[model samples]
Target: MYSPVQPMHIPDGFLSTLVSIVFWVISIVVLGYALKRVGKDLGERQMPLMGVLAAAIFAGQMLNFSVAGGTSGHLLGATLATILLGPWAAMIVMTSVASIQALIFQDGGLLALGANLFNMAVIGVMVSYFTYTSVQKLARGKAWGIFTGGALAAWTSIVIASLAAALQLALSGTSPANIAVPAMGGIHMIIGLGEGLITFGALAFLYATRRDLFHVGEAAPKGSKAIWVGGLAIAALLAVLSPLASTHPDGLEWVAGQKGFLEAARAPLYNLVPNYVFPGISNGSLATIVAGIIGVVLVFAVALGVAYLRRGRKRSK
Candidate 1:
């Protein structure tokens, strides 16, 4: 199942400042690698769509669906993005979403940013992309192949990401393998099922309406203005619906509760403000909504900035 922060449910004080800082560095390095992989082919035409995808993933993450026993998990959207934009680009987009969630919403820990990015961005996009591609080829591009590949990729990414997080927790001495691994893995398995279904459905819809969008070959049609518009509309819809998402604690919290490490979680260093609430935001729902709005703008800005920078570099050459 998908874990929090994988979809941005990182609570206060989940990791040490040192661990978090280290991850931040790792994230930067991975992001740089992703940019180089993306190269200059990311044209102006892709900027708007990239922004829309960022916002959509951010908002989609907010909508937590109920899992078994009232536990809930949200959509990861990584597989869908990778399927649409290629894995390398999806890494950039997902990292933007994760970074914005940390800086703006304070939803994820600053120190753990790199670990979160590694799990959600690196694994979700890159690893899942390859897995989905393999599955697609095995299925020979049938509808079921796309559906199954999307589902399995989403599911596997969550489990892998959870393992990564668990290892971090164990290494930090905050948790033991007995507690961290099995609990995180067990809950996420359930969560990943929901992730799989949502991915399958989204891919199915895209395939039905715009099959050309999924083509990952030289002969594929260039993305059109319509795709950008459609993507934005979807992002807007997800943003509007984010407030109605599940409020239940995610897999990590649930695991913490079950394993008795819930109280052991340390507070983050950046908790200068009470409850880490952004100024002028009282209700959690309002704060979350505002964060989602800010995330849309930030993601759009970052994507456009990266695109233009790359474009400029290309023109100079």
Candidate 2:
């Protein structure tokens, strides 16, 4: 059976009810603040950028790469998004990505969405922003310094998110903190390197071409159309290639299996595009590709909508 690409997210049954509710409340509070902060500073050109970033992040998450011990990991994209679009905007983008994955693809448990959002979208983005900014300040904003900052920021974000997930699992009695933390943290340490390299490479590419995108809203950047087209094209390409992603179990799944809690995971309450395979598609690969493309479009649309709403709110105030 073909399994959809799954990230290192906690599935239902892995977390206790109280733990889940606590995270949900925390996530809601943080996201509410994010909306307010974003509304105050959202720019006209940012709508397209948000859409493109969300699409790219969603598509990128579908590509799982193999790691040690037969486990696999995928890009979290929190650091990359936070660096490109500020922490507030990045949180919104990450939320859209995680929510769509859970609701549409069933990649994550619906009940666990709150914890997932808190770990990856909220905490992850905030850590990235602060780390990257601190590094840039220390380096005095040199080119290498900025690139290094992005790389470090990306790595730090993944590790911290992993630790947070482990802590949650521990709190939920899914595993002991000592064991869960080391296991989760160790594996993600390697995974974070990949994220760091990817983030660094992306920053370098942007530095080489379309550097203006780094500070787009600060001034009117030319070739805006080309930037948008190129971004979407990249996302589409990733979606098409998603079928080739690693088939190995993801970090969380692997840990669950090893820790003897894999059986605890429950089935999704509903299914839309279950496991990224569109229904009625005879070919699994084709189904996944189509599903991924649809996901890209959906994420882009959601991000655009959020940006528009925030912009409208700003105007009204």
Report the number of the highest-TM-score candidate. 2
The 0-to-1 C-alpha lDDT of every candidate, in the order given, reads 0.68, 0.72
TM-score of each: 0.64, 0.65
Highest-scoring model, lDDT: 2
Which 10-residue span in candidate 2 carries the lowest summed lDDT?
240-249
Q: How much is the lDDT of residue 61 in candidate 2?
A: 65
Q: What lDDT is obtained when candidate 1 is compared to the true structure?
A: 0.68
Query: Residue 9 lDDT in model 2?
Result: 74
Model 2, 275-314: lDDT tens per residue? Answer: 5464468577887898999999999999999999999999
For each of the candidates, the C-alpha root-mean-square deviation to the true structure, in angstroms, is 17.2, 18.1
Candidate 1 TM-score to native: 0.64
